[model samples]
Target: MFGRTKEPPAAAQPAEPSAAQPGQGKGRPTPTRAEREAANRRPLVPTDRRAASASSKEALRAERRRVQQGRINGEEKYLALRDRGPVKRFVRDVVDSRRNLGEYFLPFVLVLLLVQLAVSSSGNNVLFLASYALLYVGLIAVVVDSLLLRRKVRRLVAAKFGDEALFRTGVVGYAVMRALQLRRSRIPKPQVTRGQKVA
Candidate 1:
């Protein structure tokens, strides 16, 4: 026949894509919602509650110790909230650089008390009058000294930091407290010493 021969049949082809071979995945069914929820669930309280509490307390104690040591070493970062600031620091230095009469007030008062008690027991009217006069004089001196210190500190703070520093809450009280404390008992122990000028 003059017509061309018919074409051969095409090779057979798969109707759908082949399945995945071995080792292709986790090889397990996906977890259901309930299974996932159960897996994630936890007890409201820890299994070892006492141990947990003890550990927490120990950690808190360690933190407090660290802060205490840091403060003793005069580390600014660990200072008490009220004592941490340049204004407070400057005021502290000012107070430390001078000897305030208020610093001796406690000891002076204790002495007067002892003297008065002794005099009262002896029934000495003259000595009793002297003690009262001395107590009044000492009180007056301390008040005068404290007033002078407050004025000086305010002036210095305003000069160094700015006038705005004068308005800082509790700054004046902070200086006065520091001035009243025995030098040895002051916290963040005085950086500047007596007669040592603070710039």
Candidate 2:
């Protein structure tokens, strides 16, 4: 007891371990604010700008193709605003079920142009007048056909759906546009054959 005085109260307790034991945490000190911010930072520009651009373009092209195919398949979800809804679908069926003079307008005009050119080359005043007369007649016929189509579509839609169906914007124009397009060139391809009755 004299040689080694009684152990002091402070030294009597065992010292606690200062460092973390293995597997006790990340085994590193907590990161400072600057260290965290630097670790999280990203470059403003892509490393491969050309590749990124090409990839984005390819993605957009693929999406367009998907939408186009969906439209051709007559999927309502993929259809454009102008082509959506059962009302529009009924209108498409009505137009597709019959032949419209408007679809022939382009071909008729082409023939008229050829006739006009031939007449001009031959300096035939009678033929020139005839071609002009024919063009006017064709334009009038197309207009008449479009008006009839609008009437028929409105009547059919109102009969099947309701008068309120006529209130939708651009319904007549949509039908007319579809009728004007060549049969083979129509989008959301026609579900019914020509002369097929539309229900």
Candidate 3:
């Protein structure tokens, strides 16, 4: 056994520092800051003026057409927005609402007349006269009101849109408008009454 451990040989010492960093020790050349800046500062020069002009004119025409179409679209949108609520209310009232006299009056009058005729078969008396009067009046009123409503709806549609196609377009516009308005409107949650119990 050796009395003391021998040190490593001096020939096996670490190597000297090179001129470049570790990765650049090979022959690869790195770009200087000036070269990078010069590359960045180069302007994008346009070539082919005829082609550019043609494309540019096409783009300009497209933009102008888009603007014109937008204006036309905006007018319809504005009108639809303005008229939506009133039109909705009107249509709902017309289509869904009951005709108080038309639905009930005619039937009521008929029933009364039948009962009167069955009860008093012998005479043209006061009851008979009154029954006839009520029947005729109710029938007339129902007919008149129905005709009036039909005429009003027709006139309104014709005046507003001029034709069925335009009328349908208007309707679609109104529907879109109403949908937009509804989206914008905030709906409040229903409040429970004091006596009500939750399911």
Candidate 4:
């Protein structure tokens, strides 16, 4: 060997691949700004019982109200199982479009309650009996109306969705409850007026 020291061998360099081909390197679409922000956030899982309970209750109430107002999608994380389709919408439309004696039941009950308060203060037996009789009659009428509407709803749901059992998921009872609610207090506010013929 001469006086010169042997030089170290050069390392092999990896060749960078060419830019991704049309479909080759587009693995996943870029995440949205919101998605990125959310990804970066560490959610505060409240450990305090009262704080957690309050947060949960508020969330539930807000979501329930949203669903009741028909502002939520069927696929939404918080949507109620009962509010999950056009079927319920159709049912609501049918119920809202028709004239239902049951709709007045709540207001009538309120009146009866006031009357009872008055009768209690008076201590009048005959008047109390008359008021009670009226309340009973009103309740019976509401019940009969609910039953009739239940049958009609089944028929209509069958006609529209092609199966009587299409409304089998407590829809009849739901319709009954909805019918009994005060009109102004009903959620997803009525689109059709009383006596309006449903097309």
lDDT of each: 0.89, 0.92, 0.51, 0.76
For every model shown, what is its TM-score relative to the native structure? 0.72, 0.72, 0.32, 0.59
Question: Compared with the true structure, what per-residue lDDT tens digits does model 1 show for residues 134-161?
Answer: 9899989988998999899888888898
Residue-level lDDT for 133 in candidate 1: 95
lDDT of 2: 0.92
1 or 4: which has the higher TM-score?
A: 1
State, as a TM-score between 0 and 1, how close model 2 is to the true structure. 0.72
Order of the predicted models by TM-score, top scorer first: 2, 1, 4, 3
Over 1-199, each residue of candidate 4 has an lDDT whose tens digit, in order, gives 8799998998989999987668666689999999999999875765687988998899999977776545423343444667446667677777888778887877787898898889989998888888889989998998888888989888887887768456456677778888887776766567677777765
For candidate 2, which ten residues in a row score worst on lDDT?
Answer: 5-14
Q: Pick the candidate with the highest TM-score.
A: 2
Across 69-174, the per-residue lDDT of candidate 3 in tens digits comes to 5443333333334333444334323322323244466357669868687758866578877877877887788667656655555555556545573355454333
lDDT for 112 in candidate 3 is 87
Per-residue lDDT of candidate 2, residues 12-54 (tens digit): 6678879867787885899999999999999889899999899
How many clashes show up per model?
0, 0, 0, 0
The candidate 1 region of ten consecutive residues with least summed lDDT is 163-172
User: Cα deviation in Å at residue 75, candidate 2?
Assistant: 2.0
| Model 2 lDDT, residue 122, Cα | 94
